[model samples]
Target: MCACKAASVTIVDGLKAAETKEKCPLCREARVYEGALHMEELNILLSRRCPEYWGERLQHERIERIRQAKEHWDSVCRAFMGV
Candidate 1:
């Protein structure tokens, strides 16, 4: 499960404690405000790695875009030259 889900669980537990007028163990354990769970989720997402091919795929796309743009410009130049 993702960290956001885990943080949501912590928030839910904290809400339950609030409803019962009891101390929230999760908050005590993490030593953070309930709202800080969202920050924890953000941190977890930032620390996560993308798929192995993600960078390669992005590079390939960049190269393809450049190639296509060059091809289009070449065609435009040829048209202007009446070729």
Candidate 2:
């Protein structure tokens, strides 16, 4: 079995402990969350052997951007019509 022998690092932002983020054990990659809480750490490590990890992440980011843009446009229209 494959495993990352390196220790996990935690990054704290200013005095906000809640904003702390953890880097991946393998490549030191980090995301918005503190750790790989969205998925199993074992699965995340295994996914490094495939390309589906980045593909899924990119698709998620694209969908998030579209959702945010839609919300922004809706708010703008609401303000423009004075309603």
Residue 74's lDDT in candidate 2: 99
Q: Give each model a TM-score.
A: 0.39, 0.41
Give a tens-digit lDDT track for model 2, residues 12-76.
Answer: 11112333454445576654334434435645675676668767765765675576668778999
Q: Best TM-score goes to which candidate?
A: 2
Off by over 4 Å in 2: 1-50
Q: In candidate 1, what are the lDDT values of residues 1-83, reduced to their tens digit?
A: 12223334332233222222333345534533345436556535644665545566556656755766687789999999999
Candidate lDDT scores, in order, read 0.48, 0.48
For residue 41, give model 1's deviation from the true position in Å. Answer: 18
Error of 2 at 4 (Å): 27
